[model samples]
Target: MSRIVLRHQEKRMIWSASSNYNLQPFKIELEQNVPRMLQQVKETDLLGTFHLAGPDAGITLEQLQSLRSQWLSDFDWNKDQAILNKFHHFTAKIETLAIHFIHEKSDRPDAIPLILNHGWPGSFLEFVPVINDLTQAAKASTGQDVSFDVVVPSLPGFAFSSAPPLNWTIDDTARIFNTLMTKVLGYSEYAVHGTDWGSGVAYSLYDNFNTSVRATHLTMAPFLPATPVQLAEMNITLSAEEQFEEDEAMNWNAQGNGYFIEQTTKPNTLGLALYDNPVGSDPRAGTPPSVIDHNEILKEVSLYVLTKSFLTSIYIYWQNPNGFKSSYTKAHTDAPLLFSAFKYNIAFWPAALLQKVGNLVYYRNHDFGGHFAGLDNPPALISDLREIVVYWK
Candidate 1:
């Protein structure tokens, strides 16, 4: 395990907390950072490879060339920055860290306060496409208008947010975010939604701050994947579609988890090596173009490069390598728990496996969409959230 030791003076300067902790307006600025990123992209030398085929083989040379070419010519960071700036961005000092978040309020006075969280290799950009939709009123199945005061925060150590202290887990994040919602933002209670690592924080928020957290929704769970032996012992049968999803998960465990191992055990080595390397910092691939287009993928890589926080962003894995070790049966919460399981997500947990996670009130298995639900299928994600928020206590 790597340790970040700060001197007393350094700790005083870095860990300084604001007396008022006011919310200050923030904007995405990349004037100086963009040119540096461009220069790095231009200077990259593609490594020769002779390996296996398919996703298991990792990114192909052609894909790297295409991404580099796009970053140089077609991809415009300014335009993407402007698009991101369209939303209302703000930052507030919470305890020891300054948190950057998008606080888009609905016009309706009765709009529910909701916080959307993103995970590793993802920034606040994941919710950009759906924030506007989430703020507007949607007609629910019961003919009632459903709108939300949407807040999306960059996780600690992510782009635009300060790095967390050593050994800071998602539970620590949940504590700070609960304060962001109830104390700083002055929301008495708020709904919660998360995917990937965000789901772990959401679960903690739901479990610990149940008084302030009204309801919770998740596209992913933090529990360990159930084994074939466990499923067989339980006599749980899988549908043909589910069997495919299972096979996909098995493949990911075998081939796609290299980054996880690196991040979990040797974050310091990997993070420093890839500090100025944008191509090396790109997020997960293998999603179809229809789910997340090439430009969108580049946008994420650009954020990591411009902010220079790829190192900090990966520290969560090191801080809590066993975050997913909890069993589904052990995760208990009284709040209304809704899970939207997309078929193509990295791991698929049927309702049967997830029902034990909490007081599950609503569970939907979407035939489409993947890990990045908001980017993959905004309409379905929006629809699912709007429909499920009605069941909030």
Candidate 2:
């Protein structure tokens, strides 16, 4: 017999004090570093903004004062934490790390499990609107049994979840999440919803475990762009819709992708720079107040700053620089794929491209939403998600 050597390791799981496997009471403990962060933000001298170069054109001195004033006077972390605690929160030890997730189940027994994953510059808060809608949709007296058991997790190295092992990649994240659903929480099948980095994870779930991952709802396609030869081989042509998306993608690649390049190549450098600074912004000014609630942005900044994982969160970029574009391009899965092409999204795959990607069962061209579909337009997102159940069987 040939010699067989197998290296094995053991893991211990520490769970919350819930016995029902579905209900748990948890609280988010804010770190004591908020004061120091506040001090830094308060002491920000636009003395530099005057002599600042073009790249430093972030929030203006006036905007900085606004954020500072709000941070001091209006922002309340406890109240927001309580709001998050309204949903059932739990932690599962996947390996040596603790995975933090909000598991909100529909009251009805037949409710389907749907996992929501957030991306960069976003937190679990992105899906709160959708979660609230889905949780309440079935309970109303409307005689509709349409809802989901939503699971929103803090991606490894973000807000609540601990930093993944330094060498971990998105494939590892997908595998661990599979174990979380099946082995830990006891679900054999589930659907996934994601945006940005989370979109990559959702695709992997559907791709790697078809039996477990029944469907996927995503805002972005993680596949690499088709080569000229491949595009010619596939005889691809653009529709009016695709041309618009193409223009958006091109414009984004040209104008909005500096952060992408920096995060992928030198995350540590930029991460170190922004670790303590809460006012990080682009080379532009005057952000859209309508797209994201300023308070919501404050919450995101507070979470990143308080947890001290602002730098580690960017590790996702280093882990999957192309957001799994190379690996996913060759992937073809039986799992039903759904794409919500939000109009102002940074990049979008055309219907033709989506059809070539997976079993694209449902496609929506949302006119009002942006890159952050869940946050930008919850009603549309909720309706589309509910309709996904129609294609489930």
Candidate 3:
């Protein structure tokens, strides 16, 4: 296969050609001379689980087997590549990096400029399901039709974007993203939404670039939930439902955060270990197949596997060890803030706690959806996006 290779000389020339930002159309093409990734999936030796069954014991052996079987027999990267190409993809040279993003604009003249951000174990691919709907106009409470000129970018060191320096953190990402929207794409002001680490970037944008980031919406907060001691000191109370949510969050911290500690302390080791193994690269196998379609999950896994981004994607965790644990004092923003809480999401922060963080304008709780709200519940996610715009604008 003939690849669209940007040689070292060409890259240097392109970099030195202009100080101004340049946005160019880009596409993902299958690379040549690559080893058969599926063959490695076929060879992975899944370990037996402990006494607990299902996700409690980690990604079940059965789940791994099913995913491996599908990859080896049914998954087609070329077909998926065609689907991805249907969207408008672009790369913008900003600062010292080239950022890859999906820039889908609506035909309507007044469509809102909205930027969606994704987090670890997820990519811009998370928003692929709702891109078209978001572009279509919807009636806001103010009786105006609202649509989005949506932009979803692959964070630095993830997907096709250039890698970040060892000391880089989410703050740097926020600065560059602000430049990407205002400086590169020329959006004077835009609304922002994010989940996971993307929420950190979104919050930073709202906090640091309030003039440029008009409003902010997030599926989760960037800061860690208040500790039990802090909650007691503050005399805050959780309802039964809230307590249940907190318990679930505690369980997740206990069980699901091993990857967090590892990635924070020694990202290089874990990154190198899973770099070439698709099965190992995929950590979502344990999520019940019902929460998100296997095909959708496979799409992300495939992107990480094929693009060779598995190593870089986990760098955020290491780069910002305190990213999620930082105090909420610095999170306050002048921009209106909106939050959508899905019942099945990994963590929960009460409205009382959130008020200290920003100008909380809208907060909704959905009975459906989970961590990957974009994939788990696009309709609810889309509705929330439309509804929140009404409050912020």
Candidate 4:
């Protein structure tokens, strides 16, 4: 119940319109000898060359080098600042930390309330497209200008939210969000949706605050049992679609999971590299920049760096190492859920797996998109989410 009241000046910063969110007078103090540390990182030769992987792996090294140079020189953080400023923003003191969020209230008093959560390597930006789409759809549907009163909070240590005062877990986050819903927003009940780590938080809220939450929707469902015996016991018959997902998970775990393991056990070490000098060479020795598409890596990395969010985001991983680990074994909710799996993310889990978690009122497997469904296929995702809201009503 500790509250940090914002003065007018602080509120102005928190609620400033997007056009004004620039890093003007940009004076973010780095630790003493930061330039020295950066020099060391740059001299390490960790980022030797660029490599394009996957089907696009055929992209020439020259092309990647050109893109990297352009991003380094031409990309404007101020432009992104303007785009984000268009939304109404605010912050609240909850449990000794300043909680930053974007709150877009629907015109209709009777419209349903919803809370959207984003996962790792992403920020409030992930919800931008869906926010536009859902609000438009709701306005059109009722013909009464009704829409969702959407609240998207940057998880503590993510984006606008305050950095953690100390090590904190996802359970701590769930409690703060629950209070935000009931106390701050004055919503007695609300629907929740999440992707990635956000999915874990959404499910935890459902388990802990079943009465306060109306429905839960998720883009990623890692809690789905992996074994065939477990699947059969849940009355799920693995479809051809589900089988494909199993294969993808197996491949991702084999090839892409080293990062996850490192983050879970020694994130601070990883942070020393990512946070100290994001644009510098990778801390891991002898890794070519070509191993990762520099454009995509830079895009993701720049978002974190410019927002001053790299440390906070990494702290979330550190605080909730168990959140990631426990995601595999968490109990299912009895409440309604809308579970959608993107075809490109087929390596994760298939729609058929929803049965293992809850009474899935709606389930779908989209063939067109990937892991970042809302960003990649906003229209389709919005349509699916709208349908869920209508059906629940």
Candidate 5:
């Protein structure tokens, strides 16, 4: 049986020959790779519950031990793998890297082209439910056959996308995605939605190539002004939601920033370690796991292990240590901007932030959902997106 291969060389050509990027393609070869039960917990010293805030902020040494035991003994990997592969997957070479993405096309004639970007600790899987629900809505609402020709690309160094050979920043990523939309997919104008790191990419597109992007939506807004007049003009009022976001950002900065620091400074070292033992230990070792909540260790490991896409994902952080900083300095876009603030996200201040940024034609502070809104509440997310697109249209 011949195996399917996605091309990457063509995309890499867009970069100048002087660019120092390098990529190597490798296939996963498994022999009797099946999920097995984790070993029983042996570390008894670390057992008990740990809290992210309030009086019970830190976990006892014993709780860490117990958490490790449970993580090692429980959690199924094979189940996770089956769930991840449900969507149609394909890869394209962008420059010197292989880019993996999920393309779900709606049969509707007037389907709008939209690119959805996911952030760190998130794969293309994050947008699956949103895509499914929105596509269905398009079929029902606009009998005119309105649908979204969706493209969910794995960020370079995550999932199926190839890693960068040298340090590439968010601008580099935006350029590559722009090519993907204009050259590879052949879309003249498209809508873009992004969350977390994705928001940075979406903002870049709007700033650099506003003509190509019809509209842009972001789940996280990280821009802030240096003056008060700019804030007042933007109608920057601190609602309860906005206050909460500020508080959370402060808290995370104080107690839960080790991961970010590590990723920004020594991503390569950590990436190699994670690649070797994607599911070896509890990812919640030093801090309270809830604060930095992620899927179980087994699930995270499964994502990297089965796909062998660990290095690819890590390379994004490794190459673009200053990506976030660079994104902050980029000019604001005059295009229509939509901001969605999840209830539990403390780092978001929708009303005030949007007012200060630019023309926030649409803004919603969702009463539910969190950082991973698409995954946590797909139905609400889909409805919000549909309504916003309709209003803009």
Candidate 6:
């Protein structure tokens, strides 16, 4: 009801100005709303969402046609909604904002408490791949502490979460989420894993609350393009794989920068057009620079459509240029940090540079997968996350 009531107020305060986080079970009436939204999609001017021709097109006339056909004939809202209900969902009001999250605890005492955050064009859904793996490992670990009690949140302004306030930044986000983990969940100390926009929040959590925020893991980091002068001075060496990844990241900046520029400068313009159509948000919204399979892409689009959270999802770009800032130049913590770079990711920073930011303990390079490693290469992300256990305790 709250989500429906707060339609598209870019600058309006959507929640009560209080910290009354009365946890409520999340339930959506997809049966009642899906048909109406689908009708809007049928009447949508999708031709505008696309502009390119030939090989490099945005969503494409063909992709748009395919999405409509799949929505009408193949998509199953009931089955998909049932799958979502399988997980534990909860929402609470925090700092005049409503926060939605998944809190699933492992039965085993050996499990450690962990929080996972998602990025823009993305929601809490990105972390679904590793949910059962992390939560169920507690049962399989038998004699050891291998699994985790996972807490994954829909970052404010995305999915079931509320659109952030007018001046809300990622650091503001970090503060509220820290409250969620420590004050709401009653966790004394915890570890965090993040990707895309999430990596910024994860880093902020590690920086602001070193005591409760124990260890940090990221698939992306603070990476900048290596200039010729800097490369020569540092004697930068890249393996063949690293060289390919560097080229891919640079190419993405050239080709994919439009989405970034529009969302950051004029998010409301696009958000308004897509407000009625849930396909307004697509699986591609959450993905990195890779060709996602049709089925995988459809599943993500369906979730946002059914939940009616797509419009608010794009608000992240407008809410915070930097998520939860923490730049005490003289301050540094020995909190163990672990990072992994997928071959096709948008950016990759050298380990030496990562050390300048925080305590660097583990780093690795994957031969396969891209930016959405959690979805594209779950096994590798799982193994990489498990790698953190070595230094966690």
The CA lDDT of each predicted structure is 0.79, 0.71, 0.78, 0.62, 0.60, 0.70
Off by over 4 Å in 2: 1-25, 48-65, 138-144, 225-242, 275-291, 326-332
Over the stretch 1-393, how does candidate 2's per-residue lDDT look in tens digits? Answer: 211111010011213212223323457877467678778777866475364435244345665567667887888877887787787787767776678898887765556678988888888877876787786554322334577878888899988788998888877888878877766666667788887888878888878888888888888877754443455577877667656666666666666677778889889887875522322222121243223655777787888888888799998888776574653353456878888887677776766677766888788886676776666777678877776676666
Q: How would you encode candidate 1's per-residue C-alpha lDDT over 1-393 as one tens digit per residue?
A: 111122223224323432267678898889678888899889977765644476446776677778888889999999989988989998999989999999998877667789999997788988887899989978877787889989999999999999999879999999999888777776767899998899999989988897878788999898876766777887888888788777777767776778889899999877875522222111433353234767878888889888889899999999989888655654445778888977777777777887777778887877767788888777778888896557864
Q: Per lDDT, what order, best first? A: 1, 3, 2, 6, 4, 5
Model 1 ranges with Cα > 4 A deviation: 1-19, 48-55, 274-291, 329-332
For model 5, the stretches where C-alpha displacement exceeds 4 angstroms are 1-76, 138-146, 222-236, 274-297, 308-312, 325-333, 391-393
The TM-score of candidate 6 is 0.83
How would you encode candidate 6's per-residue C-alpha lDDT over 234-280 as one tens digit per residue?
Answer: 78877787777777767777775576667777877776654212221
Instruction: Report the number of the highest-TM-score candidate.
Output: 1
Q: lDDT winner among the candidates?
A: 1
What C-alpha lDDT does candidate 2 achieve relative to the native structure? 0.71
Model 1's alpha-carbon lDDT is 0.79
Name the TM-score of candidate 1: 0.89
What TM-score does each of the candidates earn? Answer: 0.89, 0.83, 0.87, 0.74, 0.72, 0.83
lDDT of 5 by residue, 266-309 (tens): 76666664421211112332232122233443455555655566
lDDT of 6 at 320: 58
The worst-scoring run of ten residues by lDDT in candidate 4 lies at 276-285
* Candidate 6 error regions (>4 Å): 1-20, 45-52, 138-144, 222-229, 275-292, 306-308, 322-331
Candidate 5, 98: how far from true, in Å?
0.8
Q: Residue 371: error of model 5 in Å?
A: 1.3
